[model samples]
Target: MAGTVAATLLVVVAAYRFRSSRQDRSLPARAALPGNVNQQLSGYTFTRSEGGRRIFTVRAVRTVALKQGGTTELEDVVVDVFGREGDRHDVLRTGLAEYNPQSGNFSSRGSVEIELNADPPPGGSNGRQPAYLETSNVTFRQQGSLVVSDAPVRFRAGPVSGSALGMTYATKDGWVELEKDVRVELQPAAQNVTLAAHDPKSTIPFKATAGPGLEAGVVWLTAQRLRYDKDSREVALRGPVELTQGNRRIVAGRGTVFLDSRNRLTEMLLEDGVHGFETTDNSSMSSAERAALRASPSSEPALAHSTQSGPPAHGTESVPWLPGSEVQRERGPLPEALEASAQRARGIFDPASGQLRKLVAEGGFQADSRRGGGDRKQPSVSRLEAEQFEMTFEGVHSEPRSGVASGNVRLSVNSSATSVAPKAVRGGRPPEAKTARATVKVQPATQTETMTAAEMTFDFRAVGRSLKRAQTVGAGKL
Candidate 1:
C-alpha cells in the first residue's frame, strides 16, 4: 500500500509539471521545431522545489508530440519524490508514459515499478529490502486525486508481501483499496523497515508470529477485497477473510487490523461469525510420555476423585479434562488444543513487545477443549459458554493467566472414571483409595459436572505445563 501511495505521489507530481510546462513559461524552454511536423525533444528534465529544497524531479530520455490528440509521450521516464524532511527517497520508473493537459489525465503505457523509502541508513540495507511495487496500465484522474489500475498488482514491504487483481488510491482522502482476490503473506522477522512518508524513527520494531504454537511458521491471509486507511492506520478485509499459520487457523466474515505510526500491530478485530483453533507444541505428546511427566517425583500431588454421592467443591474440585489436562493424573496431562467460536472476536497487542496482551470474544461465545491420551471411547471434555469472554496473557511465552465470562456463563466438564479399590481397608470404614492407580473394584462409568452463573471470573494457576485450578466469582454454583 505504501508503494502504491508513492506511485500516486509520482503521478500527481508528473501531471502538475506537464500542465505547468504547457501554460507557464518559467520552466525550461522546449526545443524549436517545424510547425508542420510533430515536435520532438530529448533529455527532458523538470524539478519542483519548495522552501529552497528540491521536492521532486522528473526526467525522460525522449519526448514526442502525439498528432491525433494534444498528448505528450515520455520514454524512459523516472520520477523521484524527496520527502519533506529530506529523509525519504521514493522513485517511480516506467518505460513509457502519456499525459494530456487538456483532459487532466495521466497514464503509463508500459509496466511501472515503484520503490518507496529506498534510502538506506548510513550502514546500508543490512540484508533487508525496501518496499517495492509492480503494476501496469495505471491511470490517474487529476481532478479527483484518484489513481486506478485495472491490471494485476504485486508488492513487497519488509516482511509483508501480497498480490491483488486491481487497486485504487484516493490521495486526497488518504486511503488505498485493493480491488479483488487479495492475498497477503507475512514472514517472521523484526520488521523495522521504513514505509512511505513515515520517518525511519517512526518505524516500530515488529516481530511477526501467528500464535503460540505457530511461532516458527509464516502467516497467510486471503480475502476478496482489502482497504487501507492512512489516517487511521487500519487495514480492513472483506468477503470471508481467512488467516492461517501452521496448524492454527482463524476465519471470519470481515476483519480489521490497526497499526501505530511505527507499524506496530496494536489490535485486530474480527466480526460476523468468527472461529479459531489453536494447538500447542504438546499437542503431539504421547499418552505414556504425558503420564510419566505428571508422575515424576518433582510434580505436585494429583487431585483425587470421589466415588461418593456428593459432587466436588466449587472451583476446587479437579475436573478431568482433555487436550490440556487429563480426567486422571494417571491418564496424563492432555495435549494442548483450543477451539473457540463467536459472533465477534478482538485481540489486543503490546505495541513495544509485539505480543498478544488480551483476547476478547462476544455474542454466543463458546470454547471447547479436551485432553489427549484418555480412553479412546469416552474422552474427557471441558466446555465454556457465555455472552462474552475475555482472556489476559502474560510473559514472553504468551501464557494465559486469567479469564472472565459474563452474561449467562456456563461451564461443563465431563470425564470417564474407572472404579478402583484401596490396597487396605480401615476398621469397618470403606476401603480408602490412595492413588489413581489403585486396583479396579467396580464398573467404569461417566462423571459430569456443570456450573452456571451470571458472571464468572477464573484465576488460572500453572501446574507444570498444565492448567491447574480456576477460582470462579459472581456466585457461580455447581
Candidate 2:
C-alpha cells in the first residue's frame, strides 16, 4: 500500500509539471517560411521591463500562420519571460524568434510585424514616463532588416512613415535607422517641415515622411542642421540655413523660423553669417560665386555677435526666419546673384561658367537709428560670394515699413576717410581735427566686384550722406 501511494504521488507531480510547462512555453510566430528562418510574424505585441538585481517581467502576444513545404503551422503564441540584465531585452526577443528547432537561421519573409514597449527599468523612483515604440505591418526581411510601407512609427511626440526601406531596427528597444533615399516630413509643434537627408541617422521615436504639395508648414528652409521642438513649436538651425520660396534660395549660418498661430514659417533670424539670395530669374549666370569650400571652411574671426559656435543650439520659442518671404523672379545686379551656395573641391576661375554655389540669407534685423544708422532706414542684408570674397547686399533696398528694410542694400563708405574725437587726445588737451584724424580704407578684391571691409567700427552717426562725408579721402588704383 505504501509503495503504491508513493507511485501515485510521483505521477501527479509529473502531470502538473508537464501541464504547466506546456501552457507557458513561448514560440516565435511566422507568416511564411521556406526552409530557412524566413520568419514572418504579425499581430504580435511585446512588452519588457527590468528592475534591480532581478529582471521582473517580459511578455509577448502574437499569432503566426505560415506554409512550410506543404503543411501549415498556425499558432497563437504568448511569451512570458524573465531576464537577469546580463542579457538585454532585445537578445531575448531575438532569441525567441530563433527558437525553431528545425531552422538554423531566420531569413526571407512574406511579412513580419512586431510591436515593442519598454518601461523605465525599475530600480529607483519611477515617476518619469517610459518611451513607447510602435510599428505595424512591417515586412521584416532578415533579423536586423525590415521593409515596410505606409506603416507609421513614432517615439516621443514625433512620428514618420511612408514606403520605408533599409531600416535596420530592433522593435524590442526603441530604435529606427534611416539610410539611403531618405525623405522625412516632420510636423512638430508649430511648423510642418520636410527634410531630405541623403544619409540620416535618427533615433527620434516617431517620424513621418510627407509627399510633395503637402504643405508641411512653411515652404522649407534648409541647412546642414534643421531641428524643431514639438513641445515649444520652435525651429532652429546652424550652418548653411537656406530658405526656398518659389525658386529663390536664401542662405545663412544660424537662424530661426517662428510658426504663427496659423502654423506658418513666420519671423526669421539670420545670425553670424551673410545671406545669399537667388532669383527664379536665373536669367543665366552673369557672375557665379566661385566659392571653393575647401576641406576647412572656417568662419571669419568672431564679430561682437559671434559667440555661439561649435555647440548644439537649442530652439527658441519663436525667432525670425532668415529667408522670410523671398522675392520671386526679382531683378538684381547679376541674374545669378544668390544668398549662399556650396563650393566643391576645385576652385572657380570664371564664375560665369564655373561650378558656382553660394548661400543667401534675408531676414529683418534691428538697425539702431540713433547710432546703428543715421536715419538711413536700414535694409535687410544679402550676401554673395566668390573665391576669397563675401559680397554683401545683392541690390539696393526700397524704403520698407519695418524700418528694417528688405529688397537689397545701400551703404556709404569713403575710400580713405578719417575721424578724430576729443577723447583721443593724449593729455585731455583738444587736438586739431585734421591732425588727430584716423582713416577708413575700403579695398576691392582682384577677381570679384566686392569691396572688402577691414571690419572697422565707425561712429558715423553724425557723418554725412555721400561717399565724401567728413574728411578728405585718398583714391586707390583699382
Candidate 3:
C-alpha cells in the first residue's frame, strides 16, 4: 500500500508526458510531417502548469515514430511530479515506454523506478533512506487515471519493505490492490524524527535511529492478497494471514490495518479464526493452573507444615512457588510459552510508542499451555476457555500486565506426577502396648482439577509475567 501511492503518482507523470507531446505537435499523426518517413527526435522536454504554478515536467532523451498514426517509442524518460510544491518532489525514471494516443494508454517497456520524499526536509531526510518503488512492464490508462502491472512490484520506505505479484492502482478512486502473494517486512526504523521532529538546542539535529512506534525488532506479514483504500486510510489483507514478530506469531483468515493521516499505524483487526502462539524453548500453560499452583500451596496447611514441602524460597529466585519441595519437583517448571485462539481479535496500538496497548478476542476464545521442562518426571498441561478474552500491556517491552476472561469460563489443570503421601510417625512402644495409639494411614492419589465460572480476571507479575492474583465473578465450582 505504501508503494502503491508512489506508483500512482508516476502514472500521472506518464499521462502528462503524452499530453504535453500532443500539445507540442510532436506526436506523429496520419497526416504527413516535415521529417523523413522514419522520423526520430531527441532532447524532448515538456512542462505542464496550472494557475501559474508548475505541476510536472517530463523529459525524454530519444523518441521514434513506429508508424504513421500508430505508437510512439520513447527512451530515457524522467518525470518530476509537483515540482512547484517545493515540499514534495517525487521523481520517476524509466528506461523505455510506449504511448498510444488513440487508446489513451501509456505502457512501460522496461523497469520503472519512483523515488518518494526525494527532497529532504529542513534538517534533512532525518538520516532516513528515501522511499522507493520499482516494477516492470506497467500500463497507465489515462482515461481512467489507473496504473496496472502483471509483473512483480517491490517497494521500501523507511523501515518497511514488501513485494507483491501484481498491482493495480486507481488514482481517481484513491485505492491500490495487490493481486496475490503479498509479503511485507518491517524492521525498526526512525520515522517522525526525520519528517516531523527537530532539535531546538542544536543547529543540526542528531541522527535519528529510534523507531516510529514498533519495537526494535523485525516483523513480517504474508497474505494472499492486499488492498489499500487511501480515502478510508485502511489496508485490508486477504488471508490466510500470517504475522511473525520475534518469538510471537499470529495467523488469521483476514486482517485489516488502520493508519492515521500521517501514514502512521494505529490499529490492526484480525478476524475469522484467529490463532497466536509463542515459539520458544519453554513450555506453555494456562494462567488458571499457574494461579492455583501459586495460591493453593500457601492456603493448604498440610502442605505448608509438611516436611516434604518444596525448597525454601530465595530472594534471588525470579519465579517463586510455595508448594512442598516434593510437590514442586512433581509439578516441574512454570510454563513460559502461551497459545491462544479465537474467532476474532483486535489489537489497539499506542500511537506514540508504536506498541500494542490492548488486545481483545471474542467468540469462543481459548488459551492453553503445557510444561515439559524441569525436574518433574512428567509434563503438566493447563487450559482456559471462555467466550471472550481481553488483555492490556504495559512497559517498553509491551509486556502483558493484566487479562480478563468472561462468559462461561472454564479452567483446568492436569499434573502428570505421582502423588506423595505424608509419612506416618511411630513411637517406640506403639506396637505392643494397648495404651499407645495407632498412627493413621493415608492413601496416595493423583487427580486433575477443574474450575468453572462466569468471569475471571488475572493480574500478572511485572518481571516474569506470571500470575500474581486471580479473582472470579459468579458462582464457581471446582
Better-scoring candidate (lDDT), 1 or 2:
1
Over 4 Å off in model 1, which ranges?
Answer: 1-37, 43-61, 78-91, 115-131, 189-217, 281-336, 373-375, 395-397, 419-444, 459-465
Model 2 C-alpha RMSD vs. true structure (Å) is 19.3
Error of 1 at 326 (Å): 22
The residue pairs found clashing in candidate 3 are 213-354, 284-369, 284-370, 285-369, 309-324, 309-325, 310-324, 310-325
For candidate 3, what is the TM-score? 0.64
lDDT of each: 0.66, 0.31, 0.66
How close is each model in CA RMSD to the real structure?
A: 17.2, 19.3, 17.7
The digit string of per-residue lDDT tens for model 3 on 404-478 reads: 999999998876645434344566543445433543434323358898999999898987766688778777888
Residue range 101-209, candidate 1, lDDT tens digits: 5885668957887665555435454232355667899886766656689888887665567888987866345566889998887654344222234333222223343
True-structure lDDT of candidate 1: 0.66
Instruction: Write candidate 2's Cα lDDT for 376-454 as tens digits.
Output: 1122232322232221211111011111112222223222222323334566555555344643333322222222232
Which model, 2 or 3, shows the larger lDDT?
3
Error of 3 at 5 (Å): 77
